[model samples]
Target: MSGPVWAPPEPGAVDVHTHVVPPATSFVERLTATDPRWARLVRRADRDDVADVVVAGRLFRTVRRVAYDLDQRHAEQAARGLAGQVLSAMPELFATWAPAAEAADYCRAFNEWLAEQVVGYDGFYCGLGIVPLQDPAVAPELLAEIGRLGLLGVEIPCATPDAPLHDRRFDEFFTEAERLGLLVFMHSVGSVTEFDHAMAGTGAIFPARIGEALAGLIANGVLARHPGLRLLASHGGGGLPASVARLDFVRGMAPPTRESMPEPAATYARRIWFDPLVFDAAVLCLLIELVGTDRLVLGSDYPFLPVDPAELLRDPRLPDGLVDQVRSENPRRLLADAPGTKHEE
Candidate 1:
């Protein structure tokens, strides 16, 4: 909200939000017939560049070579002038509805596979592992293993199984993540079944759900308690930057909200990281105004949305030197500050 105050640095950018679907062969081999609501690769008879991901006996979505082919991804990155990417699992693979044990197994296999990919690719990729939030008891163990596997953090949906993100059920998991200094990437899975029509087609529900989840987290005091936990909200933190004023107004009139929040909701939001994927330069400027430049990182939602990071940084509306921070320095700060890494700052 204030004018950009910090000086910028170099131009190399690190994307903090990118999704990957493991190779279909590996996905099938890891799951047995009894696995719950698993994803299966369906090769199209006619196309070499595309594949459909089938989950629970229905087509989930279509993906391209960029989703699994690192070589192709690298080529795209070179053309776009990106330095690297932080990889997260496809949102559909979350499968939070599955039984806790089964979900944990799926996550383990995925994390192991991701770790292998990160190791093989070395500097090109940073991985965020999945945890079974449906089963809170097993989540801490999974979080621990994610660290052991050399992942910088864990990726979780905006909400858990029985409760929203602010619920007490996830306290232990957040505590452990904070203790371990892991980053928590909050992504939306478009699973709000109540709004079937909205969530079913066009996938417009993701941004709305992301916003609701963020509001829930703030209203429920999760940020207040786990101040040290590093959190990243995808899709420009949904509508949070624009809704801060409304939230502040409501907080003043709402006693429950006031009691739960010791500071302005916008203040807590300012501490969280957000990716600049809103697709509008004006919106991006507002986001920086609301949360400050340091909170933003270059996240293109690569292979899904063909975002041009250089174009965004080159926007004439932005303040001097701000591009350098969002394009490179901010992401480097995030990685350096993550737990279990020698790059602590």
Candidate 2:
């Protein structure tokens, strides 16, 4: 948060958090008859640009063209002075609750389609793939496929259907992710069903789940075990920054926690990246203080909550050069290692 004013780079800021949904024609009929969790888009008769995402015969949520139309997404990014976006599958499509093989097949189709979608956008967009974490045994193969497809990395939910991220089952997957230099974007599905029961709500639960995932990684030594892993916590680390002191406090009193953890929870927290989507300048500043500027990236969660880079610059409490770092430089560093992706020098 403290540094000399940075000379503004060129106009293209990189948004690390955005999502895209594939057209229903791609998979709806193919999977709907057999797959209970298949999500299909139903166009709204009243509006041309919007549609409702339906799953299991239930209304999921509504989305606009920006969620799937690359042309419109590119235009919007240009309007906001952004040069690029890192797109991931909508968490709803994750379908982690399904059987492992079923989930893997669905993920494979989506990953290939998303990777192909990035080709037209080229330098303006990179894509993140998903793996079937329900069966950790299959994760490494899927991750390898993701790498083969030239994806920047994979989007991971806060927890599997029955296991937290820290469970031993995921150690191999994490190991492979580190070896591949893939970015692990840990985003909660915004469902209380994916996290601990105590952390529940419509508005507050999303961040709470993300915080829990971050804490679990640190406390369970996932970060320490795989130091080379590129991890990005969404929603500004989703309460981790605000609650780090409590994590440290607990570690001090619990001898077992200190013995098991390789370093202070806050120390591990700083080593990872976070998206600056806290929605409050003061909170963003605090996250900067906790994680340092190099680890904070711009994440608009585009289409759901499109953010303008100027919104970050408008805040006086933040340092003068932070916009360039969070919106441009840091994100480039995050995606630089991926094949088929572009980055500024």
Candidate 3:
């Protein structure tokens, strides 16, 4: 811990999982005018450097300038020997509970703002915008717009308040995403509109929900239908590693499951990608064993999780060459073919 535990990988590495929030003042007026949901949430603060994020008149989290400051983020990543980061809006911004049109407008504006920020960072950051999945009809058009806006992909909730990732309502969006070869980054929310009131904010819902979403995607044949799609799950795919075997066993006993998946649960699991931000070396090893080395990448839920990423990567228990793969090679390869705006100076 005295010095950098792991040397920066050659050419530096790309962090595929990170988050950002636009300054509330940027859209608070339009949002508060139409959507009380947002009005009660992201009000403007007196200073740009700090703001309290309120939800339903309660403080959610305090955000700071680093959340959107390009120069500071660049220098911070550089200190860790990272060449760039893929920036996505925080999960709360998904706003699946809002009216479809309002959500779409917010997503479009946020994406445009994010794309502009990415361009301003030159090659230091890559943009992963959001789409209004609450309205399946509009989501695909916005997804195509994401590509045009020079963003690498879209970050979506692992499951909407009312629908799972494989719900047929969204098949069109996923279809267009595959056809366009865009990355689909799925993150789990700690609380959503549909969860039981008693279970809200218990903190266990996030990872468990990711596991459920993965199972739904596999069992309902989303991956089978969109073979070319690239999905990167946040938090190392939640509880999938420990439960995959049980899933395989259940699929074997259930004819419907077999009919949909055609392969073992693990087969479909391997087809998806995961970020190694599980916060434990043993868990990281389990994920590698489940999906192999090629599918793993660096994910520091940065600005929230304060641990030094290099220290996490330096664990001796990790397999030889695994550090370099996760820290440097894997993310670069995954993003190398992205159609987003070039980061080259």
Candidate 4:
């Protein structure tokens, strides 16, 4: 708890998971390029004037630019910032996410561009491909292209509000992902929509629903069948370890999920990896204790959550060397084990 609390992975150890929204891309680029003038501009723009929300409707009209400055220059700005941050925190690692929805062609363009723009940097970046899950038939082709591009994995949203992760339609996508040796990344909200998250605050904890869907997918035999396909849930799997019992208790009622595979709720934790964005030292310790260190990786949720991943790894609350594995080694293995990936850059 003394002396800087956490030192991010010696600059270049990639932060395995995070989101890149409009401003994030902007800020990241600005910071990475060390644009002093732009940095000062960002500093001034950084202040958020949170507006009042109507409690009943849960509506707020916050004033801010939704478009990121990075996108304007074909992400030239974002690349500069992200690359700098990766190098600054841990040059040994980087993060990845799938591209836009019209993936059949754009997916290829994005992946190739990503590899050329990012991964080709060699030790600078690696990526995952995003396919239009709405059209499963084309996914494999994109996955094939993703592999050809030397990208690391494919990112698919687990569930949207209209379609839960268990929706049979998504099964084909999972099957293809497994077949390609591509890992399935259930980006937290990918499992389900934010019906409850809208309630705000304290509701965020306890039986976190997103975590349950992730567990449900694994226990329902998704992971069982695709054992080789690396499956990871972002943001500490949205409280995965803690919700196991509850998930099991609910899933126990469904015979299909129960009979599919695995003995109990425990199987999901064993099969899937959880990113370290839980944001609590004690909770992180609990996750390691529940799922073991290998299943946990550093998901900084950077530029979003104020939490510093490097600091979480260094917390006195967890066992020694846990941080190193979470930040450096675990991700290395995750990317290493991913299929169709050629480990470019």
Q: What's the CA RMSD for each of the models?
A: 5.9, 5.9, 6.0, 10.6
Better of 1 and 4 by lDDT: 1
Candidate lDDT values, in order? 0.78, 0.78, 0.77, 0.52
In candidate 1, position 337 carries an lDDT of 70
Q: Write one digit per residue (lDDT tens) for candidate 1, span 1-345.
A: 111111112247888899998876554555636663677667789997988777766666788978987778777775767777888998877888888877888898888888777654436677899998999889988888888877889999887667787888889998999999899999976653354442264257677778888887788888888889899998888777656787788889887787667789898898899988777789888888888889888887777765576577678887778777887888988877765444313
Candidate 3 lDDT, 1-345, residue by residue in tens: 011111122477778888887765546566766555572334355766656665544556766667767787787778767777888987777888888887898898888888778764446777787998888999999888888877888899987877888899989999999988889999987564444441355356777888889888987888888888888999889888877898788887887888778888888898888888777888888888898989988888777566756566678887778778887788877887677534443
The alpha-carbon deviation from the true structure for residue 212 of candidate 4, after best TM-score superposition, in angstroms, is: 2.9
Give the Cα error of residue 226 in candidate 2, in Å.
0.7
lDDT of 4 by residue, 162-206 (tens): 456666666776776677777666664321125555334323532
Query: How good is model 3 by TM-score?
Result: 0.88
For model 1, give the 10-residue run with minimal summed lDDT: 1-10
Let me know the TM-score candidate 4 reaches against the reference structure.
0.66
Residue 53 of candidate 4: its Cα lDDT?
Answer: 21
Give stretches of model 4 more than 4 Å off.
1-12, 19-109, 190-209, 247-257, 339-345
**Model 2 C-alpha lDDT per residue in residues 138-187, reported as the tens digit of each score:** 98888878887878789999887689999989999999998887888898
